[model samples]
Target: MSDSILFNVIPYAAALVTLAGGIARLTAKEPAAPPSPWTPAGRTVLAGASIVLFLHLVGLAAPRAMQVFNASPARLFTLESLGLIGALLLSWGLLTLGLRRAREGQWGAAVAFALVLSQVLTGVYVAVALRWASAWYLHVTVPYLRSLMSFQPDATLLQAAPLVIQVHVLASIALLGAAPFLRFGRVPARTPASVEPGLLATPREETP
Candidate 1:
């Protein structure tokens, strides 16, 4: 597909699905038992996600401020370093969570975890191999995302980005599009009944 359709068209569709899914999840009836409290892996994932998401949101919403922040070499290094740390934590948590889900036969959750793990891994590689991404991100990615938000997506800058960066962006969009069904749309596994249906059968008395 063309870059225009990939970057422009896909993001809007993903965003719409994410928004609708979020609303549906909020209004959906509660399960008989509430979801279990966060496990250690879950907490780790949340912590890392908080850091990573906060930085991305700020960069997207306030590019000029990010530019100013990245202008200082020391500050830029710190930002990139922190981002890498968050990525590491995210990956570790995903590894544990994915394995556990796979072992339990929760294939749907396992797939979600695997996709997210790949997404986080690509992001980590981009931050390292691309080096100074915190600085350059303000120039290309931030603007591309802003244009997307404004309904005037221009992939010109993104087209010029490295293949890995392009893959990272595309993966994120795909994940977003899938969030409704894969993430928020999941249902709890059903437990087996205490008594087997076959065991409940009774023999009829012989006719006199």
Candidate 2:
């Protein structure tokens, strides 16, 4: 299989696993104990997803680097820098979330997992948009901008493409940086171990 297909498989699989885990957590019958801060199943699933995503990012970068020989330096730089930053953020967010969830308990884990997942999904969407845009635009605009930077810097600055890309880059960074903090901010004082099962406890009758 092609590198892109292979690379994509990891994240897709990760996403599937995460979805399944989330569903299981949602449907599980509450135990007698309060929900634990951490659930073994939840941590394992989330951790696996995070590792897969990390590999996916690395896979994504390899092709871009290879394309550098044919592409303009400026365009290549922009793409590489943005991609690297995005990957780093993704890694950090996933690692922090996974580790915290494993150590702290279920609530912490849920918060971290949710935040990281949100960022991951958002990033996937953005990447799809970017890929579509690159293909539809004939891949000329990026290379052209790179070439124009030295000769007609002013004209390039006036173009909207770079600015738009920059916005996306910044937004991605913000999402990564903020996710961890958000998870922490909402953490409850006491972690619930397990929820009580449906049956009610009965009172004993008084002896005669």
Candidate 3:
């Protein structure tokens, strides 16, 4: 079906972005910079954000774990509660971080935070609007993931999903692709190099 084809292609496109971004990071250099001053509040916010990111990924890993654990309704409900908590943490963490960055004149950082908030809000909406989506997600996504891992993606499982869910999937793919380039998981900054006036000149230009 066309829907399934789109799902399959979108992941690869997102992957391309991630791969390209990573390669660009690896080959690029940065200017020398002094170490940033860290404060207790900054550390707390960072730790919270890290935890929220991990909590978001937990759902992806949970299905296998749950299968092994023989997941029940009670356990599923607990997971649902945990998802809500993660969403709350994400919302709070992002809002505070965005405000702090904006106050410090870091408009770019503030904007990035706002962009991330959209994703978090989408997830929160799903958690609320789509009843038992977490449980259903396992049945749909886990298999699709397993298939992809084996180099054979089967998007048919999710073809019948609502439009919002499809959009969510695409957004997740974009996030995965972009995360490598973003501050959350970016590579170390390389030392900057000075370029001479004729550094890039050809043989004719080097004559003087």
- The 10-residue segment of model 3 with minimum total lDDT is 181-190
Over 4 Å off in model 2, which ranges? 1-64, 69-112, 132-159, 162-167, 179-208
Candidate 2 residues 1-208, lDDT tens each? 5433322233344445556666665687855444446544445445555644453444344434535432676764555445445544555555565656656666765565665655555444444555533221224333433333343322232234544543443334444344324434223447577758655667678899
> Can you tell me which runs of candidate 1 are displaced by over 4 Å?
23-32, 183-208
lDDT of 3 by residue, 9-61 (tens): 66777778888888888788966456656544456556656755564466566
Q: Candidate 1 overall Cα lDDT vs. reference?
A: 0.84
User: What are the root-mean-square deviations of the candidates from the true structure over C-alphas?
Assistant: 6.5, 16.3, 11.4
List lDDT for all candidates, in order.
0.84, 0.46, 0.68
**Best of the two (2, 3) by TM-score:** 3
Per model, how many backbone clashes are there?
A: 0, 11, 0
Considering lDDT, which of the candidate structures 1 and 2 is the better prediction for this target?
1
Poorest stretch of ten by lDDT in candidate 1: 181-190
| Model 1, position 204: C-alpha lDDT score | 75
For residues 124-199, write the lDDT of model 1, one tens digit per residue. Answer: 9988888976665788788888888788899899899999988988899889878877842233557786896667
